[model samples]
Target: MRSIWAATAMTVLLAAGAAACDSSSAGPAPAGGLAGSTASSSPSATPDLEAGEELARGLDVPWGLAFLPGGDALIAERDSGRILRLRPGGGTPEQVRTVPGVAARGEGGLLGIAVSPTFSSDNLVYAYLTADADNRIIRFRLDGGDPETVFDGIASAGFHNGGRIAFGPDGMLYAGTGDAGETSTSQDPASPNGKILRLTPEGKPAPGNPTTGSPVYSLGHRNVQGLAWDADGRLFATEFGQNELDEVNLIQPGRNYGWPEVEGDGDTAGGRYTGPLVTWPVREASPSGLAISGGTAYIAALRGERLWTLPLNGDTAGEPAARLQDRYGRLRTVQVAPDGALWLTTSNTDGRGDIREGDDRILRFPAR
Candidate 1:
């Protein structure tokens, strides 16, 4: 019961005091004090799924989810800085642009969306936002115009603005920050706020980072939303837990995921953290966006609406199976769609769940 749980009153999970304790209560979560072990929401042996369709709907708060190489996919609307482009068989999603000065407030706007693994010819595309003051990472081109600041100040708070951004597997560009609530800026390494950055795609600093020109790479985190890359590349992350566990790390670089002072797997009696390839129970799992194909690594549960698959053995991890629990409720972000299916997003409209009425969708499972 020690390892941090009262840090300035447990914040982050889209802060604002956990979105005002997530409206009223998302229930069931509290097993924190973890650092490992807790993958058995029952029903093992894998196989389980009979439906999944939505494709794309009204989409109000849909935050980040890149995947384009013809199959089309590039969504982001965390409060409407817009950036649609779903396409694939469903048609009608196409908005294609809109980023200018996005400051959309609370849990910040236009979060995560990457697609520039050369992006077919550098037509680029990258964003991780919350502007009006800070928390940046831009790069655009998909039809629109303007947007070229590769990295900016960071530290956007309405509640810990750590927006997730991905593009790893050596291609660099991995962001994941938050500490805007200032918990000592996650141990300030000259402050990049909570940290987990690695650039180069013009953002500079990426060449086996660990301080050379600095892009920090790894250093105590508190709100890293997700960044997958497994299949031997090993580098998973999905942190955001303060009042009782909620993590899923596996990152390496300058290592030191002990935030404010450690959350789930700490106390060798004195300081030193990094223990999570597992942990949930911050009201079930406020864990957001995270995906890995075939060998499993799903995890997209906002207050545990479900989609926690885990089964990756190699760098270690196995025993987790929750798949679509509350059906299609919260669960924001999860990709791997280029035909190989498995795309999810539906944050119940973001004011916090039960919205329905085309509330927020983009479901579609069946990942080989």
Candidate 2:
């Protein structure tokens, strides 16, 4: 039965518009902005809930978020480059003063955050951001201390600078990067952009990396904005495809995923690239900031304005089912909190979208 099901699935994907090289095929593009970008949908009926209890509103374009050890949350604002500490009860946000050298530009800034595994003792906070010349990763003590540039020299562009970071179960730092809007760079081995990078905590290359002394873990990614590991330690990632295909992939070290070459799943003989476990039309899914828990990968959709739940069995990813569709204006980030609930942030303030005053909010949902 499993073999028959796999064969049927393969046949269906082959018939769909999968490859980028197919002249007759065109992928889904976002409505008003770039080819794969999306616009805001109409607002849904507001739910009747207690104010300031489940959600903490009044955030100014919050981008990345990390949970502190003491049940507090630290969030970063994209435009202002400020990191705010959100207290449990949620009054005024306390600003952390030590962040330095953030180049806030198109889809760039302090983009992703992760607390150190030893943060209780080390007080270290790591951020992936765009600098004046390039996209880099930096680590700093949370108590208003000078930052140390751990890894430098990743690619950067006005868009597609893929700035999501997380500490993997191996105690190594993993970063997702974009192709910097250059199609060719996604397939290039030497370029850091359009790749998944693995590095040591101090910014050195991990010992078991596929490339010797190089941080490239996986290649041929357009813009990877989310990374998560399952309970079995299998890695999964969400990527923004160029025009039509947005992908959820079971990431493997040193594997090439077809980007400009092959968009989704079709002919593998075209190259040695791996196919996505699941693909969605780009208009329906510009996936970012994914979190995995209880055998499901929860993905935050930017242009799609939805939360996608993809069931996972080991390293294999099933079809993505949409949740909260058209309910949130523009969902930017989704994370699993320490308390096991899913926390989501809206991207209504992203400048490209229709800005609803006070529309940007952090919402928490019970984990299913």
Candidate 3:
């Protein structure tokens, strides 16, 4: 059950968000604004629940968007294995660096990126990518210096290769990995695949992990694509179900999520795993990058082609409301920017969707 305070906060947030969405200008954006870019969508158009503008377009399968201190965004391109930096004031993107040895196969490639917690001082950036033999993470200087592998040897197949990384409130790095199409790996305690892992910046296991000498924070995840945390430090992750269901789970340390044995809410008793906070049919939500803001969880949906806002009350989630349904094709990520806005990335150019001329864009909602 939700607390009174949480419910009240949720109400205020929804009202404010709705007001902002409705008060947008109906006039079209400037004619020359989208010139020289592959931008088919109108930046002036207001989606159902949000008014958004295209920040950048014509990207090559942009997987992750990490905002830097000065408001520059570093976007990771999956197939091209490049990290492009886009400044705030509308200049052409600069290719900051290309990841070495990325295997850009199906469902794998240069994936998630996280700027170092001390990026202002250290200039380090971390990336998770599929290499020749396995999935691995490399930390390197932002100035294109040599890299060092922090962790490696996770299974990387053609599909189900999970790749989402974030820094938790404790400043430790957390990663969500997939089962790599190997269901058994979800239950394998020793396998790095299909688990949420906590580690130090250097790739060693964090000190207070659920198990000593191991980075495995939780197991039994099939294909976790997103991770976020609420104000109470409660962790949440979005997952891909094999065929029928998609899930947003409240992640608890050491808890099993019942990968092959259970899908959605199981009626069978005594399962050795936790049920997801909410579930969706596969067609409605192939859940991806998630963000928590003002007591609501904003989830990016791929197959659903919308954004889902799930109100949060403590550990429980309210009914989800779909936003921008099919207005933008295949939303890939939802990130809360430093300026209290939401950054959305489209996945239309990723070969899985029908693309307009100006596809694969970064969109921004000034207020959420």
Candidate 4:
């Protein structure tokens, strides 16, 4: 689906974003490596496989997951564009509402979900999906009412429509978008595709953006599928790379991550694009959704069919370890619940991989 370089930069950026922002503002941060660039050599500890438990099943190609404050989970179906709500204790999923204007061709459809931080008051939910002409992000009121479109007008294609949304610590909305299957768009600052976008609750550009209040935070990404923020307010993202390098990158406002120019950690022709903090071979990690907590970042792998654990020390990401490899086929999305547990979804019905009947399910793991 994505190039190896995109994957690596995605992971590194996600960790950086979480480690660099403030809990109250979600504003941009100074560009710098975490902890003076002293790379930590500690490897990820072996995960206790028995700790992960399946929480729900019968999901049709679930792609995105968002947790409500009351411990319920919202799940998105890629093909049907239906959003389902699952209560704790595991019962039948209730279809909340179907998203409108979704183009479910190739790797596009209902992709990412994020609830407003002030959900108790706002009752707002945001989603990123592929539209008929492009990829778009929209916010809807989820208080048992009709869905409303808040923002739209992103680029899309048959593949590489980076679709992930998250509310920053500042209560603003941040979206990760793909380059719409085109390599050059990643480097085009004018294009909304292949960039991390910062927007207010009403879909306007957040205050203090890179440009004079422009929505594009940073450019030069192929397909970004995950976003997260740590306790210190830093931001991180996961991206799918070209054939060779998949990336995890630390995201800085207005910084460029060389996508078509460079793959993995290397210099590019169009100036020095930032390299990934952590790079993985494409075969090992076609990482998607990412979650940061307890000084670690969790990445869900699609082609690799595993969960990768990366220990974090400030902005630097330590070596990563693969967990549950081959145990589940094509892990798609990962989210950190409000109670600090990790919720993951499987993507067996996406048509690109093996569709195991009842293989697409939700699993929860205790965050260590």
Models 1 onward score TM values of 0.32, 0.83, 0.86, 0.84
Residue-level lDDT tens digits of model 2 in 59-146: 5567898888775777877766667676544443445542568888889888998999999999999998888999999888776556
| Model 1 agreement with the true structure over 229-339: per-residue lDDT tens digits | 876788899888889988898888898888778787766234356677788778887888998875788889887888888988877888888876887778988877755
Arrange candidates by lDDT, descending.
3, 4, 2, 1
- For each candidate, the alpha-carbon lDDT, in order, equals 0.74, 0.75, 0.81, 0.77
Scored by lDDT, the top model is: 3
lDDT of 4 by residue, 302-334 (tens): 988999999888879898989889888898898
- Whole-model lDDT, model 1: 0.74
lDDT of 3: 0.81
Which numbered prediction scores highest in TM-score against the true structure? Answer: 3
Model 1 scores worst on lDDT over the 10 consecutive residues at 27-36
For residue 73, model 2's alpha carbon misses the true position, in angstroms, by 1.3
Model 3 residue runs over 4 Å out of place are: 1-49, 267-271
RMSD of each: 20.5, 15.8, 12.4, 12.8
Pairs clashing in candidate 1? 29-284, 162-177
How many times do residue backbones clash in model 2? 4
What lDDT is reached at residue 329 by model 2?
74
- Tell me the spans in candidate 4 whose CA falls farther than 4 Å from its real position: 1-49, 268-271
